[model samples]
Target: MAKIRLADALVKILEKEGTKFVFGHPGEQILPFYQALQNSSIKHILTRHEQGAAHAADGYARSSFQPGVCVASAGPGALNLVMGVATAYKDSIPLLVITGDVSSQLKGENVFQDVDINAVFEPITLQSHLVKEPQEGIQLLKMTILTLKTGKTGPIHLNIPRDVLQMEVDQSLLDETVELNLPNDWSNLKPAEKLVENSKKPLILAGAGVLWAHAVDDLHVLAEKHRIPVATTYPARGVLSEDHPLSLGLLGQRGTKAANFAGKNSDLVLAMGCRLSERTLKGLGDVPIIQVNLDEKVLKGSVNIQADVKKFLEKIRKTPPKNTDKWLEQLSKHPKTHKIRTNFKKTPLKPQRAIKEILEGKDDSILVNDAGSHTTWVNLLIKALESPSLIFSGGLGPMGYGVPASVGVSLARPDKKVVVVVGDGGFQMTLQELATITELDLPIVICLINNRSLGIIRQWQELYYGAPFQVELDNPDFVKLANAYHMQAKRVDSPDDILSAVKDALKLNKPVLIEVIVDENEDIPLPE
Candidate 1:
């Protein structure tokens, strides 16, 4: 049997797992692994910052419904990826995160750039372990993939030492890692099915789990066929097309009034792939809930079923619709929840008007969102179409996610143009990725809502505290910044020009930034 370096063998194993790309920033300790990648077909994306690489990997995972892979060197390199990893974990996005470590002998000693990586990541990841040997790494890789797909999906971390990566492995040992299989799919659905059959005014609360299970179509069919209204969690925005009459839009904190109303009045709630967390269940009183999720620990519904959302929906789809004329009539009274104000004529561009204009004449572009007051507007005003794809940091609200995530989205879904909605505060955080977008020449439209304040913080400060301080921003000329990056840049100071400018930018089909000037008054009206 021929021998191979452990790093080379791991790359081969990643290939077997259908990993096509790995986003990362390399350091000296991981150079051996990087060298081994030279002979493989796996594409490596070099990001300016470790956080960018992690978020890019997250974007790819969220967009593709496949495990996104990212690499970082040990200690500081691994530490920088914490924000992105925690964000993905909060949202339950599947990712395989690799970090290079010091040689095993020096792990506990205060070696340069060395820390307890596994301990640091254990809180954020489903599993965090250091690879002890080449054979152990092969098995760990397989286990990581299986764990990601099987139960509560989230990120996993593997810290490999430099020497361990360079250790020689007997080529025949590779055969031991050849076959992979998931255990018999387990879900207790009989009680769930019975509840579905009996409920008259049932509402389906779809979560990010629906997307992870790749059951968007099945969910749509279940809601439409049964005529049950569908209210998605923030991350599950596009699970059912927002245009559908039965769609209630997002529920909870940043929720639509209609969705919250339905949650309050529904006789029964069918929560699929999403835990009925406090953020999602606000204003929701006691109601019988049938929850289907991959993670058993989070199943707190009245009828908890550990099942794949797609499979569960498939089985429940056969249940016929109940007579719900009264429910529909009551819900119709709250139909004002999802209307995009198409005609806001505010000076200094209302964020709502800006979103409408940016989205005008758009055909299902993948929307990437950054966290801020602008995020509320993007979520509130924009309507997801048939097969809508959206990526945002739901669990952990991170500011710099949009730009780098868009890079990953562009690479993963080359056919669809990317529309990134960001606030000045958030954009400034990961602004360096503009270079990455330009270097790849990705067709991305950056809608930078340049309100010179941390708008959301100001809103809270004024509303609840009767004072606003430290939230205002001192911004740079974003147009000049974009130009400096050798990308097309436009500044829209007038609200009316947003429509035409964004339309033109969308047509360009290349990387461009539209900085729309706005004030704090233009932020989202209090969330319903």
Candidate 2:
């Protein structure tokens, strides 16, 4: 086997693993890897910031169901990826992070751009490695990939020293194939199946695991065959079409009223692929829960089954469909309804009206939302037609995730329509990615909800603290900002103009931005 630079060998390994895109910025320490990329077929996306690269990788992983790869230099560049990595870790998304470190001989010498990246990422990654020797790099990478594909996927870290990356290594070592052999002990699934079969008024609570396991079709089959209504967590919103008869919508603090009502009254809660977070279990009284997940640590139910979601559902589908007509009809009669003025005449538009207009009849489009009070509105109002149609910062709730995530989504699914909804405060967080969008000529429609404040924090202050502090934001004209990035843009202040503006933006062949001015004081509705 011929010898090649460690960085070149790493690129060959990545190509063998089916990686097409690498997102990150280049620096002096990582120049060897960048030089290796020049002759490679893999496309490297140069993000404006390291955090954007990490979030973009996160979005790509969530939509494509593949491990996303990102790189950064030592010190602050690698540190910037911490928040993005933590966000992915919390959501259980598979990501591979490669960071350059100081040379092996310079350990603890305070060399330029040197920091102990492995120690910093210990808590946030499933595995962290510091590769000082060239021979160990490929084996560590194999281990990282194997761990990512196994149970409960999360981010993995690799910090390679600058000298090690440039050192020569045998090509045969890098070309070795690693196989994953995971034990499948479905012993506990039978109990869960027996419980589901016995319960008359059972409800299925689907979560992000449904997407992770790629079992959306199996979930639909099981739900339909058993005639059990489904209530999803926010991250798992679109596992079943919102309009499906079995759909009870999201159930949580910001969940739909009908979903919360149905969840509270069900005798058996069949939770699949979700952790049953505090937000989802808030007001539901002590109802018996049968939780099925790959990880047992997060299970909080009467019975826990540690197994893959898809396999468990397949086995459970053997039970014949039950007649729960009476229960479904009773629940259907009490659907929680709220009045929303879709056609408001006010100059400063309402948030609900804007969301309603944008989502009107666009059931098939993919929506990515940023964190803030605006997220509550999108989660409560927008309906997704398929699995993974809605992507949001579920556990971390980072403010500037929307724009960069949308850029990654556009690249992953170029044929599908992608839309991003971000508040003024959240929009400014990663707004610099507009250059990336324009440079790539991705046709993503950005809906900027301008409220001139952090609405969620302001709402909390108004409700409990009786005053707003550090909530007000000074923002630029988004229309002008979009123009500066050479993108088509429009400003909509009236509710009547929202639908038409969004339609126009969607029809454009290139990236477009719609700035929607919303009332700062128009509070999001709370569940009764």
User: Against the hidden reference, what TM-scores do the models get?
Assistant: 0.95, 0.95
Q: For candidate 2, give the lDDT of residue 363.
A: 40
Q: lDDT of each structure?
A: 0.84, 0.85
Candidate 2 has its poorest 10 consecutive residues by lDDT at 334-343
RMSD of 1: 2.1
Per-residue lDDT over 1-528 for candidate 1, one digit per residue giving the tens place of the 0 to 100 score: 799998998898888778889999999778888998888889998899999999999999888888899999988999999999999988888999999999999989997987999999999998898998988887788778777766568999999999999998897766674343432244456767777777888889998888888788898788777678889888888678787888888888878888889998898998988987889989466898988886877889998877678878888888764777778778878863566675767575667777777776455788899999888777777777644477889889999999999988988898899989999999999999998899889999898998899989888888889989898889998999999998999998777787787778878999999898876665467755
Candidate 1 global lDDT:
0.84
Candidate 1: stretches off by over 4 Å: 177-188, 339-342
Q: Write the per-residue lDDT of candidate 2 for residues 289-404, one digit (tens) a residue.
A: 98888776787888888878888789888864357888798779755334455567776778988888887724456888999888877776777778679888899989999999
| Model 2 whole-model lDDT (C-alpha atoms) | 0.85
